[model samples]
Target: MKLEMLDTSIFIAYVVGLLIIALWISRNEKAEGRNTEDYFLASKSLPWWAIGASLIASNISAEQIIGMSGSGYALGLAIASYEWMAAITLIIVGKYLLPIFLKNGIFTMPQYLEQRFDSRVKTTLALFWIAVYIFVNLTAVLWLGGLAIQTVAGVDWMFGMIFLAVFSIAYSLYGGLKAVAYTDILQVVLLVFGGLLLSYLALVEVSDGQGFIAGFSVLTHELPGHFDMILSPDNENYMNLPGISVLVGGLWVMNISYWGFNQYIIQRALAAKDLKEAQKGIAFAAYLKLLMPVIVVLPGIAAVILYPQLTSPDQAYPSMMELMPVGIKGLVFAALVAAIVSSLASMTNSISTIFTMDIYRPLQPNKSQNHYVHIGRIATLVALGLALITAQPLLGQFDQAFQYIQEFTGVFTPGITVIFLMGMFWKRTTSQGALSAAIGSAIFSFALKFTFPDLPFMDRIGLVFLLCLALTVVVSILTASKEGDESSNQSVSLDEVSFATDRGFNLAAIGCVIILTFFYVTWW
Candidate 1:
C-alpha cells in the first residue's frame, strides 16, 4: 500500500491533534495537587459515558483490527464469537462482579484478591499481571501496531513501534488514567466511524460500486458457507472456536477472565463515580460490542470476495484500506492509529497502577500520595520501554498474532477465573486453597498443552477450569476450620445486597441477552 502526500499530511495532523486534545483535557491532572487517587483512578470521578468509551477503546486494538480481521478472512463469521460473546460477558460482569469490586473500594484486581484471600495471593497475582501486561499484552499491541503502520504507510517496523510508544506514553505518563480514559472518548468515536467507513467501502467495491445493502446481499447469497457461526468438527478452524463449545465451554472462561477480572479492561469501571454509573457504563460497552463485527469482521469477509487472490489473510485489512481515496484514507488510518495508541495507553496505565498500588505501596507503606504518584509515572515509562524492546522478538514467534495471544493467555485464565469465582461467592474458600489452585492450574494447563499437543486450546481451557475448580473445593474443605474456631470466619463476607440488581440495570442486561441470542440464532 502506497501513501500519497495528502494522506500523509492528514494522518500527521490527526495524530498531532489527538495529542493536543488529550494533553489539554489532562492539564488539571498534572498539576501540583494531583495525588495517587487522582493519578491512578482518575480521582474516581469518571461518568458513564467516559467509562464506556474508555472500556471499548482500551479493549479494541490492532489485535481486533488486524488479527481478528485476518481470522475472518480465514475462518469466516465464526471468528466473531469473540466479540459477540463479549457482549454477554460484559453484562455478567456488570451485574455480578462490578458490585463486589466497587464495594471493597479496590484500586486493582489483585487488591480484591488480597481482601478475599491474603497478601500472598494478592502479591503473587499482581506480579503475574505485571509480567503479562509488559511481556504479552503490551508487546503484542506494539508489534501489531508496528506491523499495521509498516503495511499501510511503508514505514520501518522499529520506527513505527517507537512512534506509537512515544505518543501513548506522552499524555498518559504525566496525567495517568485521567488522560487515558478521557482521550479514549475521542478514540472510540474515530475507531467506530473509520471502521464502518472501511467496511462500507469494501462492500461497495465488492458489489462493483453498488451500495452497501446490495453488496451485503451479494456477499451472503454468493458466499453462504462463510456465514456459519457454528463450525463443524471437520472444519479447519474448529479447533480455535469449536462448534457448541464457543457458547458453553472455554470461550466463557476467556471472556470472564478478560471482561470481569483483567486489570486493564476493568479499571475503567473501577473509576466510575458510583455503582450505578459503572453498571450503565458496562451495558453501554456491551452495546458497542454488538456493533464490533460490522467494523472489525465484515471487511475481512468482503476482502475474500474483493481480493481473493491475496496470499495472506493478515493483508485483508490493509488491502481494503488501500482502496479508499486520499482524504478518507487519512481519516481511516488515523482511526487505526487511534485504536493502537488508546489500547497502549490503557495497558501502560494499568501496569503502573498494579505495580504502584498492589506491589510498591504495600512494601513501602506510609508514603505520601505524591510519592506514590511519582513512582507510578516512572513505572509507566519502564513498562513501555520494556515493551518497545521485546515486542518484535515476541511477535515473531507466531503466524497468527491473535490466536497466539488467546492460546497463551488461555493457560492462565482457567486458574485465575476459578480462584476469583470461589473467593467471591464461597465463604468457605481459604487463602491456602486459592493459592494452591493458582499454582496447580498453571501446571495442569502446561501439562495438557505438551502432553496432548493436538487437543484444541479451547477444550484444554475448559478441562483446566473444571479441574482447578475441583482442586479449589477439595483443598478448601480439608483446610476448613473446626467449630467455634474464630479463624474460620476470617474469609471475606459476601454481602447479598451488593449483588442485588436495580430495575434499570436488569432491563438493560435482559436486553443485551436478548440481542445476543437473536444474533446467534439468526447467524447459526
Candidate 2:
C-alpha cells in the first residue's frame, strides 16, 4: 500500500513544518544560556492547553496507535478499558496528586522521593526508570513506529526507525521540554485528526459508503461481541482485560502508577504555570482520553471486518490507512509519525531529567546549571541511541506489543504505586519501607506468575499491590519501633498543601465520569 506522490509531499511538508516550529520554539534557549530548569521543565511556563496536548501526545504513540489497535483487532473493544479507565485516573491524579507535586516544586519524581524518603530510594528508582525507558519503552515505541511506516507507506523499517529517532532529536535536543511540549500541540491535533479520519473512512467502508453512523450501527449490530466493554471469563481476551477487575482492581494501581507517578506523563503537568493550570491541563487530558478509543480502537475493529486476512494484529492500523485517499493518507501518516516522535521526545526528555537531576546533579553538586543542562542533553542522546540499537531485539518477538508492555511493566507498577501512595498520604511510611516495597514488588509478582500461572495478570497486579502496601506499612511500623522514632520522617508539609480544585475543574471531572459511564453502559 504505497502512498501516492501527493501523500508523500504532504507528509514531507508536515515534517519540515514541524521541525521548523520546534527549532523556532527552542531558538532562544541557547542564546539566553541553558539551565536545568529551563531545559528540563520548560522554564515552568506551560499553560493548561500545551500541557494537556503534550500529555496526550506523549502517551498515545506507537503503542496506542499500532499496538492497541492490534489488540482491538484481536481482543475487541475490551482493550479500550485502558484509555477509558485512564480518563477517570487522570481526574484522580489531577485532584489528589498534582497539588502535592506542585507545592513541592520538584523537578523529577526521584527528587520527590528524595524529599519524602532518602537518596537511596531516589537513586534506585531513578536508575530503574532510566533502564525501563531506554530498554522497554523507547525500544517498543521505535519498533512499533517503524513497523507502522513499513506497513502503511512501504518504507524500509530501519530507515523509518532512524528517521524518527533523528527527527525527534533534531527538534527536541536543543529546545528541550519547551520544544517537545509546544510541538506536541501540533502533534496531538494531527494525530487526533488523522486518527478520526482513518476511523471514519473505515466505518464508511464498513457500511459500503452508507456513512459513519450507519457503518457504526452495522458494526455494533453485526459484531456485537466486539462491542463488549467487559469481557467475561470465557472470552479468550479475558486475560488481557480481566472483565470487571479492570474497573475495580489492578488496573487502578496501574493507572495511578502511569498517570500520577510516571516521569514523562506527569512532567507535563509539573511544567505547568501553576497548580490551577496543571489541574486544568489534567482535566483536559481526561477528555482526550475519552476520545482516544474512537480514534485508535475503532479502526482496528473495522479491520476485523475489512482486512480479516492481516498476518498480524499490529497491522490493523496500517491496513486501514490503505483505504485513505492520497492527500488524506499523507496527513494521517504524518499524524502517526507525530504521535511516535512526540512520545520519543517526551520519553528521552524525562530520561535525561531523571538522570541529570536525580543521579548526576547529586553527585556533582557544585556543577554550574549550564553544565547540568549539558549533561541532560547528553543523557537524552545516549538514551535514544541505546533504544535505537536495542529496539528490534527487545520488541521483535512480541505480536501484540501493547499487551507485552503492559504485562512487563505490570510487575513493577505495584511496588511503585505502593511507594508513591503511601509516601504521599501516609506520613508514617519510612524510606526503608518504601525501598522494601519497591524491591518486593518484583519478587512477589514473579512468584505469583510462576506459582499461579492461571491467574490473570491484572488480578495478579492487584493482589501484588495490596501485598506491597501491607509490606510498606508493616516494615514502616517495625523499623520505626526499632529506631525509637515513632514520628513521621516525611519532610514535606502536607497540611499546608491543599487538594481543592476550582469549580470548573469539578464540573469537567463530573463530565468525564458521565461520558465514561455512558460509554461503558452503552457498550456493556
Q: Number of the top candidate by TM-score?
A: 2
TM-score of each: 0.97, 0.98
**Residue 484 lDDT in candidate 2:** 54
What lDDT score goes with residue 161 in model 1? Answer: 90
Best by lDDT: 2
Please state the error at residue 340 of candidate 1 in Å.
0.5
Clash count per candidate: 0, 0
TM-score result, candidate 1: 0.97
Query: How would you encode candidate 1's per-residue C-alpha lDDT over 1-524 as one tens digit per residue?
Result: 86889988999898888878778867876664788888888999999999999999999998888888988888888889999999999999998889888888889999888877778889999999999999999998899888888989999878999999999988677878888999899899999999999998888887889888999999899877678999888988888888899999999999999999999999999999999999989989999999999998899898898889877787788788987998889889999999999999999899989999999998899999989988988898999999999998888667678898999899899999998999888878887788888898889999999999878899899999999999989888877773223223333565544777779878988898898899889989
lDDT of 2 by residue, 427-494 (tens): 78888899999999999999999999989999999999999999999999888765453334444568
Local distance difference test scores for all models: 0.88, 0.92
Q: Give the distance in Å from residue 424's predicted Cα in candidate 1 to where it truly belongs.
A: 0.3
Q: How does residue 66 of candidate 1 score in lDDT?
A: 87
